[model samples]
Target: MLSNLIRQGIKPTPLIVCAGGTSSRCAADGLWTVDLRARHRQLIINEEREEVEVGTGLTMAEVLQGLQPRGRSIPVGLSTIPGCGFVLTGGIGPLTRSQGLALDHIVGLCGVWGNGNIFDLSAPTNPASPGTASKNETHQQWKGLLGAAPFLAVVTAIRLRTQKLTPLVIWRSVCSVQQLEIAIEAAETWEHSASLQWAWNDNIELFITCCADDPAAMEAMQSLRTHLGYCPESSMAIVAGQHAQPAFGTMARAADPQERIHSEVISRLGPAWGQRLPSLMADLKELMNNRPHAGCQISAQQLGGASAQIPVSRTSFIHRNAIWKPWINATWMACDAKGQESALAWLMRANNLLSDYCPGVHLAQIHPHLSCHHQELNDAFKNWLPGLKHLKSHLDPYGLLPPL
Candidate 1:
């Protein structure tokens, strides 16, 4: 298929291979799109090893459902979107604080590059592997494709190491700006069993999840209550269930699928941003006072446990020191041109205001269509770009995929 396109002298949108079709990286003029959803839809589970080989087209929810009965789970995104693009770009999720990014669990990959050459990347000792390359050679290729596969290849399948399934205790609370700031500070120093996700949409809502009922979880909850001034009888409810139950389901229902919404996302990494939350919240409140749409929101996720312990050089993901992932997003109706412009303008201002606090960006929320895309990419990859660019040049000389 790629050879035919190349022979015909055609270059389509770089998003041709995206399984979720969620990125804004595609050409605005609507170039040809290559859909791979129909081709790769299989899931092969290795129960003994707690590993699953999945088609790139599969969503995180689907994978979770498949693994639920087997008492296994993989670190996945908060949304039930396609898993391939998520892992390829350094997947961040609710369990990131404990399990680390999803990319860290990848054991193997199979794909075709722009040159129409098929390659299987893994540890090389597995006999079922198709690549005959030496161990060192395969390892080099593995490092390159770990987080930058979108820029070099069209991945068809991935084998990921899964973890033992465990139930999670979730606590939700609504707090003021000051209370949220206090909670953010508390979450930064939380243990591996606890993680946090909070959102601000006029009101602040925090979701704290713990994998166990240990003393660490109890202390974390106590600290939150003390900081937020909430007592046991003060509407602070703790719900317990499987991690898969509320993690993605709540997010899935947040928006109406039938509505056509135009949105922009800006992600930033701040290692010590929690310390400046009070000032940041003040600035955000002022900027959001005249928001273009009611659906506009800001969210921050704590990320400093196992996710931060990993060295930056181990994978193409470079934001190892970051303790927080904060993003500002705004949405407007498709026909509301004025609303869209206003929302985008406000988002740009908000991003610029918070830029000094954050030094890196997440690829999952990156939009190449934005004017600051180049700068964002530079911030996200930092010193890692040179190696990634070399790999792209060697494997995709024609620039079949979008340049990062």
Candidate 2:
């Protein structure tokens, strides 16, 4: 791949940095990439609540399913699929309101630096050697590696705090923006807010989805319902009305009533609305009734749960503070240039809206509009820039890792 790029007179891009290719089909056009699993070999969950150590390869779903049996789980995105790319970009999910993005819970990480040196970093205390050294010494050691980005390394593993696995309750429905705005406004104003939330406008291809769990989920839902003020006719008469059918992949799953309606709606992905954005609630209803798109589906997740406690000073993830993260997806019958271009254009618009309030996004999913240079991007991390740069200098002087 490197030789091909050089032969083509193109500069060498980073290796193993592309994500799962869900963000855009064009991502598959790139060469040399790795998923979370290929990068790390093992996953270790401590006997007690000590901590969970994960290889970069594990997806959010894998992490949850692995640890849930042990009464422990880490906050991951709703799209529990695996990839180090999201965490590197910014991990947001149902845990954002509570646990925050996956990156926030990360206490330590192991990865190969640009110079090919492997390094392990964590908060001052070393769990593997708890009794070997004084707390002071361990803390001093951990403090030496904060604010570092993958610019110096390809992350292989991560250690993070964990919590008990609780039953999840999902409430969803398809409605127009008008019906949804009431809920959206309530959710936006809630004391703690949602764990995950997202919306799709007219120009975008997908309808929005949001999720909120934990104790506050019930309360948030109630608040949203109250603000939405659903009436009997209005509720039952939403877009697609009662005749909506579920999309292909979603038909087999057991979902809440709202999800059933949402599944029916978001499947529609044509250029129907023109320039006028659909009312949040109305759009959802239309999606259920219309099944608009021939090749795409749109959705969003409400983030809450364990995601709120963590701050933004950790790794490269920066959406730890948003109310929700939105995703625009396109699935076509074939992978071709035309299909790829259509998906990319729609995704670009959706991502542009998503990045409005949430700036930092997964680099793998980055759209050209969101592109930024080194210095401007560095300033986004504030005081942490100096430390990350220092780590890059020490671990990857050649800057082989992908540029953030």
Each candidate's lDDT (Cα)?
A: 0.73, 0.46
- Candidate 2: list runs displaced more than 4 Å: 1-13, 17-30, 34-39, 125-150, 192-217, 226-299, 302-315, 318-321, 329-339, 342-394
Give the Å shift of residue 48 in candidate 1: 2.2
lDDT of 1 by residue, 1-404 (tens): 64456445545645356566666642256666556567777889998877999888777777778888888888776666555787888887777887888898988898887666788777444434455456555655677787777777888889999988866666766766777777877776776577777877756777777776456776777677776775332333343334344542233134544668888888888787655777887887787677778778888777778888876766778888887788888788899889888888888887888778887887776566778888887887888888778777777777777776
* TM-score between candidate 2 and the true structure: 0.63
Clashes of each: 0, 56
TM-score of each: 0.88, 0.63
lDDT tens digits, residue span 1-404, model 2: 32233234322455544333344311334545545445464679986655888776666566666776677776555455645555554465554555555556667777655665555766643334446455643343333233234455566677888865544434444444465454555555555534324334332211222232334646666556566565432221111110121121242123312311111111111111222334434544454333333434455555544444444533444334544443445433343556555555554444444344345433324332233345334434546556556656655565555454
Give, for candidate 1, the lowest lDDT window spanning 10 residues.
232-241
